[model samples]
Target: MTATPLIDPFQRTIDYLRVSVTDRCDFRCVYCMSENMTFLPKKELLTLEELDRMCSTFVGLGVKKLRITGGEPLVRRDIMTFFQRMSRHLDSGALRELTLTTNGSQLEKYADDLYAAGVRRINVSLDTLDDQKFADITRWGRLPQVMRGIDAAQKAGLRIKINAVALKGFNEDELFTMVDWCAERDMDLTFIEVMPMGDIGNENRLGQYWALSDLRDSLRERFTLTDLAERTGGPARYVRLEETGQKLGFITPLTHNFCESCNRVRLTCTGELYMCLGQEDMADLRKPLRDYPEDDRALENAIRAAIALKPKGHDFDYSRQKLDGQMPRHMSHTGG
Candidate 1:
């Protein structure tokens, strides 16, 4: 029997799913988290088997693209085993693409294994290029380690994309440098505007939110950017350098909104299905999955109900005065 396709109220065909394997991370980036964080207990996280079942349900509902994310996905134990299990779907015709987003702190050790498990595309979150500045932003991150990880991933025959969170007074001056760096390596670079999601203890620093429009204008001064008409099933809008074959992307949630075309949903490690990143609307999948472990129909019904309730757009107006506790979920918990 054919299952019904999952569609939001706005008629958006939801096909992309971002799954967070764990909320634990080693770095405490100023923009991502507070100095002190309380992570979820190991018992509270979804087991590998549960994740597989849920993903299978999503795939059955016409989800073709799956992205594995986390506070840092590599921090999870036996994650490669999970990857191998999911690779079976990709091996068959059930799945189209399987990608991952990581901080690149531990990619050096697991890059080969990830490739062997059928992961070809990767996105690494790197905020700065300077070692000292990297350490400053990430609290205790070593720039060399991340750089080594990037190199290893490239060597392992993976398509690498650098996800840089554009923060003023930090790496804003190095935007052109970053472009050049990626161009030299034939890698695609994406600059994301720092979002005010969650209590990262830096709400007062909202002035540092760099608009993507401004970044685009700045890049135009140096290089010719030709907009690409193709969509990668993600929020980022891609462009090509007229002089070189390098591609650049911008994720402007603050300056420019992309919610009208939002075709994805996020699932936290504990089975919470977030309909939108900037809103508090979610469906509790853990309870249903736990209670009806063998009932695929129940799981699909819960997910479809959540999709039906998905909001038209997020209510993140950055111009408004700072409210008390705007966002309830942090980036780590929500799988940013």
Candidate 2:
């Protein structure tokens, strides 16, 4: 039987999938979520078996790249075992790349195990280099611990990328320092413009949103950034450093919308398929997956129906809407 390929309304081939294993995290970054919050119950989250089945279905559909994300993925119990189970697909050439996006708190403990389980690429979230600033932003996170995790990942031979959320009053001063830090280690760094997601006190965070265009201009003063013809399956735009030979990326969803080239979809921990991060269009996959666990045809049809309904682009105009509605915009909940 011939399988149907999953293409969206924009004719973009959907080959990338970001799955949120859990919405729980150790650090509550100011830009991501508020300190006080409610998380989904364990029963509500998709089990390992269910996640494996869903991943297999996506792989069969046409997904080549799979990224395991979380509020913090490492915090999920026996997540390495889950990765090991999925690694079989990578070993069998069923999937092209298996990657993880983590908070780096538990990377030191799981880096080696993760590599052994077929995860070769990792993106660690590190906003400020300053310890005090880190604590201030994350409320109770320790910079030293995250630093050790990054070091451990490098030692484990994993390709590391530092993901920094660009906030105006917070980490703006450290942008150049971050570039130099990545260059010294021969690592790639990506700066993402803070999006108005969820109820993380948008009023307080509104002043912190920094545009990527301005950030690029700032980089030009210190270093010459040569545009690199590279696509990473996600929204980031890659560039090469003329002097240090290092690579830098920008994910400017707010200032510069890259929705036209958006080739990925986010699956929340609770099994909701979010077509766009900025919009409220989502398909409930948990009910379908749970209702028809033995019916692969039913599961596949549900996913295909959702993918067919993916919009051309997100309606994210900050000037008009503040994203203050009851929609789930929390990055943790949406598998950022």
Q: Highest lDDT: give the candidate number.
A: 1
| lDDT of prediction 2 | 0.86
lDDT of 1 at 219: 89
Off by over 4 Å in 2: 319-328
Q: lDDT of each structure?
A: 0.88, 0.86
lDDT (10s digit) by residue, model 2, range 87-200: 988998979999999989998999999999888899988998999999998987999999999999999999999999988888889988899888889789999987777777
At residue 95, give the lDDT of candidate 1.
Answer: 89
Worst 10 residues of 2 by lDDT: 319-328
Cα lDDT tens digits, model 1, 60-139, are: 89889999999899988898889999999899877899999999999999999999988999999998899999999899
In candidate 2, list every pair of residues with a backbone clash: none
- Distance from true position, residue 192, model 1, in Å? 0.5
Give the number of colliding residue pairs in candidate 1.
0
- TM-scores, one per candidate: 0.97, 0.96
